[model samples]
Target: MDSDEKDSIKNESIEEEVEEVEPARKKKKVSREDDHEYTVFIKNLSFDTTNEDLKECFKKFGKINYALIVRDNVSGHSRGTGFVQFEKKESVEICLNQAGKIVLQDFTLDLMPALPKGKVKQIEKEKEAKKVEPKDSRNLYLLREGMIMAGSTASEGVSATDMAKRLRLEQLKSSMLKNLTRFISRDRLTIHNLPDSYDDAKLRKMVVAKTGSKPIECRVMRENKPTPTHPKGKSKGFGFLSFSRHEDALAVLRKLNNNPEIFSANHRPIVSFSIEDMNVLKIKERREIRSKLNNPTYQEKLKIKKLKRKENRKNKSENKPAIKGTRKAPKQVEENEDAFSGFASKPGSVPKHRGTFKLKEQSKIHEKSMKTQNKLRRRQKHELEVQQEKQEKKFDRSVKKSKISDKDSLVAKINKYKDLLKGSNDESTKKQKSKKWYVD
Candidate 1:
């Protein structure tokens, strides 16, 4: 070969070697700085998924360089998030396109391109910047669009979107205020901490006494049961009083608010303008809806309930007989030889037919018996009272007799002792007189 041709061949070989090294260097630079472009961040991963499991899940999509589940350092448990790095950036695009459709170990994955370094911090800063501080009186006008502030540039002009938002905010404020005011009833007052003995009649009388005016309507909230002590219902310690005039309601509120004498000790009544509670309003609305006959479902339910009640009534009537009271045994009926062939005949016996009594006669008999039993019970109670009174009187007479006997015995003993002392004194006086005479 010629010398020039040998030189050209050497140069060509050197050029090919340089080209291969350049491509290799470029690949290393791309891997180091552009790794985020080829990696995908998967969220909502199953905690039980391991690196091998994740890799197996995505291996069908593309060649994966690595699959890892982000784990807590101390506990060695999955953080429910991980990263999947592919050999090419195209694989990341393909995986992201599948996004929510990818399921790994019974978990739907949310896939996104892995953020480059410092990108997350930038996003957080942008979010913080987007948050608006609460506007008060000073900056309130500034928040409203189309309001020209002094010494400010108007080059941007007023944005229609900002103006619309401001209008919406105003509407929202008005709606909120209306809702708040709607809860207050104009001519009604709520009374709390009422006496347990106060029912509708007593509560109305109290309102008339305190306020010196009759209320239009008064109701004490109560349990849904009728008790012996309270025939209507038991008081729930609260009530509502409504007046025809708003001024009268206000006057009643002032008279009853924090009134310590109205209720028992330590129970001061709390009276205020009746504010309808939302939960109570909801319950009232539900009851009203249920009560409306126009609703087909409610009508059907009522029909079913009526049918059940009818069935229950029929069962009760069939199972239980009337005239449940004490009565004499029924007289035995005589059997006829022709009608009852098996019966034996007795001489001089009349054949009497069995008779059926009417319901009215049975009912009258039961009522008469009940009345007699009640009279007997009352007579027995009266007799017991009379016996108790007689016993008490006898006890009193015995106690008086014992006292009189004791007093008489004490008086007789005193008189006998006094007589004995007088006799002894006379005997001593006689002896002294004899001595004196002898001396003389």
Candidate 2:
């Protein structure tokens, strides 16, 4: 009676133990991420939109747990996006089902589930950490197969299959590692703060001078077309320099980086193994500059520049010599042959004066100067015409105001100017008609 009872009780106990263990084991494989409630991301916000407005808009679906408009970390202005937290999961689903069509501040919104503030950064960190966690399957397999047995040699009867596989893996890993380095890097030089006059030829010359070997490729960053401010495709302040040999690139970096005279004092030079780091640095730099655009110091500097430009323009106009329409041409001036030493003044040929080379040697320089002067004159003429137009409009506005107020003097002055302009136009037309050489 005792043996039978003992056996039956033991069997029941073992069955119950197995059932409990099975559920526990299965729990490890299960993930409950879908159940996680989250804040809803709302995109396409207007700059003037406030947190209060967003919260009010989100309140119709359900009780808002929290709501916030994402703002620039440095400037404290809206980044044109926001998040709304809901108390219930049903509300988030309803918002998603709306297809992000909530019109707030005249913009149809785009919506998605919002992640926690550092979730993205944390995930990136995890991915990086995972890479360094010894994930080599071959290594794991070798260790498990006792292929890494200590004090073993070829004569010790180690499996030929295991040895061959191990050697093959080692060779493959080495080759891959070498190729990986190549894929991630290129010999690059970062030229920053390029001069306004920097060109591809000059850049190549400089690179050759510093490195003693010519770069495989050289480029001076330039705009594709002229802008309102820059009438030429000017240097964009930075460029990439590449070399076939990395050593030469390193030489350039050591020679030119921060040596202001060669690369221009304004733009610094940097040598890099890869252009990626340079690009990343540029991005960060641009972000910092953008963040500081609203800064008082930067604004003051801009105002100072504007004032300086105005002053320079004023001084230039005031100091300019009057143009003489009948001035003698330089080529028509006759000179004696004995007037200069070590040079002869020949007819129909440019002659260089003693210790001074002038007029024709640097035609490009002269051309650039002429172009600049022409541009300045055109700009001044335009500005003057604008000023005149503004004055006329102001006078007309005053005349209208005077007529409304029954002031006769201002109306008379406006009429007098209008009559003068009309008379000038009539005279010019009459002159054109009288001239025999007038073009139709």
The residue pairs in collision within model 1 are: none
lDDT per residue, candidate 2, 1-440, as tens digits?
79999999999999899876454234324434542364688888999997778988888889875677888989999999987777788999998899657898789999988765468689989898777434332221211111122122211222233233333433433344343222223366555556677788888887777647787778877888988766668788667788765455545555554444564333344333332333565789999899789677988888999999999999988987888457675333222121110111122222111111221223334345446666898999999999999999999999899787776777877888997776754777678657787557
> What is the clash count of model 1?
0
Clashing pairs in 2: 193-267
Give the Cα error of residue 369 in candidate 1, in Å.
Answer: 57
lDDT of 2 at 390: 100
Worst 10 residues of 2 by lDDT: 336-345
Off by over 4 Å in 1: 1-36, 56-81, 86-103, 106-110, 114-189, 195-238, 241-264, 270-440
lDDT of 1 by residue, 1-440 (tens): 99999999999999999876454334434456788888898899988887778889988779987777788999989899988888987778888889889887778999988998788899999999998755331111211212112112321122333223323433443343345323445577677667787889999988888769899889999998998988778888788998887667655665565444566334455555554546677889998986786677887888999999999999988988677768787444233222101122222223221122332343344445546666898999999999999999999999999999999999988988887776644777668756755534
lDDT of 2 at 140: 18
Q: Candidate 1: what lDDT?
A: 0.65
Q: Candidate 2 local accuracy as lDDT?
A: 0.59
Per model, how many backbone clashes are there?
0, 1
